[model samples]
Target: YGDLSKPYGTGNPVKARCPPNNVVWYTLESYLPTLVYGCIVDAWVTNGKCPYACKFRYESNPEPGPFISAVNEVITRGRKIEKDRVVMYRNLLVERALERLKEIYWQWLKLSNEDGPSLASLWSTGTVSEIPTLKPFCSLVAEKKQLDKASRTLVLGNGMVRREWHNKAKLAKNFALLPNLESGDLNPHFAKTALMDLVEDAINYLEWVIVWPTVVQAVRSTPDGQSHLDPVIVLDRS
Candidate 1:
């Protein structure tokens, strides 16, 4: 079904209808890593941009370097405070847990419509009118005591737990620094503004790690961004 006038199938209608190979194929070996690094760098740079109006006091000439340093310091301090805040939040969680446990214990002791203590009351008060020893409930009490001990240990630990608690305390202290901001106060606007800055700085620091010079060097050393290919053509005469 081919045309006889064609040589090497070049003039054949089928050959003329063949798809073109104009599209180039590139497979950069390090493209993915480079792209990821670039993304991290961009993200960090974006994070470094301040969200709120920051006040600065100039000692001499106001340069971007000094301004940046001041801003970075603020971000660092804020992060430290945020870490501390997490500890406070954990403490509050423990307190709430203890309160819930107390509520359950009280409910279990309350009798019916009559103004009398239920049998469970003897377990808590150790009454001779009932079982000599409510040792069965000792397990529950022991569990609660263990939880309390753990909480106390976490509070007093000299490790990360302690640091976390200290940081949370520092965060609380910082909030009190603003005379306008009072204890047990909720200010969405202020919190949102402060958190935004703090988050941005943290993200920026992460980026700095991902796009570090050493990482870039390692990426470059490998074929992470390189590619290779070859093209060949054949001809025949009859």
Candidate 2:
């Protein structure tokens, strides 16, 4: 967590982000709305210095002003695959939902007689801004049920299934937690390993979904014509 009151190079309110996120600075993060963060403040450090790169001042409140509670996931562009135009549409949604959530949090603080701004405000400018939508990342439930809930939430938040790719089924499929293939037939010792393999497969599936439309392949391939690494065209999600 860091001070949310100040704007950094890309209009990100979190001072902890830009300096450490240099790799995406020029590519994925050039869009200001997509660069905003979802900060989860630790209580002890909230009253102490900023969590990692402690700013000299604001020691009394590491995360100060307007923002109190936020989902612990960063609203970054690094994870998704969308064309720049699609990203622009998604960014508008993100900005709207983001502003609404922050406003709700700030208002709850005020109505309960806590100390905060009397008005709802955005961290970037301390004023009402656009809203955005996304799945809430944390939940306490059965694993399968949790993934389903997150999937539904993400699809609804995206607001682009019909208008753009029209791949709602594909999106839902990616969100699914795949079941093991005849795990009971395997030895007991393989249970954990099988589960890990499923997890890895799920992540790889997601990667494929994101990168398939416009994945960048290295010009130089191995002798057998296999890629040696993961590389993407720099402008895929700009």
Candidate 3:
């Protein structure tokens, strides 16, 4: 993600690369999702069976807390230096893997709701060993948004609000579940929406989450505005 934080220096001045990924972007982003999610889509349409593990583990028998914390802090510091591009380049593959994992998670959520599972459990954080039997799935609650048919527009925060946006907000009502089986192959649309969500998450993390807080600290540390910290500029999301 940080690799994408800057305008690529070598590209033809118009567009930036798709945030360099170590695991070939074509295979990681385009191919794997199509293959894995394609199978899930096929199963949902036919046999009504989806396979997924409950809660995933980041590491098995993890390191001591103090050592882990120290290393993470050091990694964050390393990212501040110009020479840290190599580290960012390597972790880019990890970032892509994580995103694909999240897609699998959402697919599991879609399967979990086959025959009226508890609504509260939809967003609940716990995981169990028992997997549910999948059925021809359909989300009665999910709906389509047509930009042309929008009856009202509202603005919130720094962004405009519309039906599609509204649908996204209300999406939690169904725990971000996909549309019904009748809708047919909503995986493509779901993948696109997931990518947009990931982009927004990245923007918020860098700008509001990290940059603004650091700026506040810099201003406080130097009353006369003579701090040596570099100015951080966040480019608009592509």
Candidate 4:
């Protein structure tokens, strides 16, 4: 399959540049739950709903850890200034990827939400694998135009049905699992399984929308044959 991450301005696949596969890819699915839980906590704190913490706002501050401190220390240890900048740039990429992941996570949640768009009924069916066939002109302009009662009722009915089918393609594209055939609340295990699935799906999407594009752009922007450290690109999907 053609790499979707690389831009094809000329419509020629042969012209698309493929980077080396030597980058160390970290499997971060194990940490997804914690990251999402943090987003949830952020939301709570932002809304002043957290009892233990004061109201909070999301900030773009670089994440703090021993790794960050080490990077700072290394930069001061007479490393080439260019290499130091590369290290900082890599970390900036990680932060940007995290921001994109957060955006996609909330977007997916809203799309599949109970009352948002995709219907719980349609979600459980095999039909979710296919794009929804929605009717256009679902508005009740028929009534405004003083159409027959029968036509007005039909328009209203279709509008309600279309509302249920809203964003069905969005869910199908971002979500992986075919939802359970049985309809009911999830047990703790099942709920956790679903959350993991969502994270995995979101990461796949991030690779397409954020990771690949960013990687390609950064590679292209660098001077050809410029020597630098072999960097492991941590996507920070969290």
Q: Give the per-residue lDDT of model 2 (tens digit) for 172-226.
A: 3331321211323222222223233422443345445545535533343344434
| Stretches of candidate 4 exceeding 4 Å from the true structure | 1-71, 74-80, 84-88, 91-108, 111-238
Clashing pairs in 4: none
Worst 10 residues of 2 by lDDT: 155-164
lDDT of 2: 0.29
TM-score-wise, the better of 2 and 4 is 4
After superposition on all CA atoms, what RMSD does each candidate show versus the true structure? 26.7, 21.7, 20.2, 20.2
lDDT for model 4 comes to 0.32
Count of steric clashes across candidates, in order: 8, 11, 2, 0
Off by over 4 Å in 1: 1-82, 112-119, 123-130, 133-238
lDDT for every model? 0.29, 0.29, 0.32, 0.32
Best candidate, TM-score:
3
Candidate order by TM-score, decreasing, is 3, 1, 4, 2
Q: Where does model 3 exceed 4 Å of error?
A: 1-188, 196-214, 218-238
For 1-238, candidate 3 gives per-residue lDDT tens digits of 1121123234232336654332222222344444544443222222211234332333422332222232344457743323354245224422443334334434444434546433212221111101121010111111224212322111110011122322443355542453322112223343343334433343333324335556787678784535566565688999
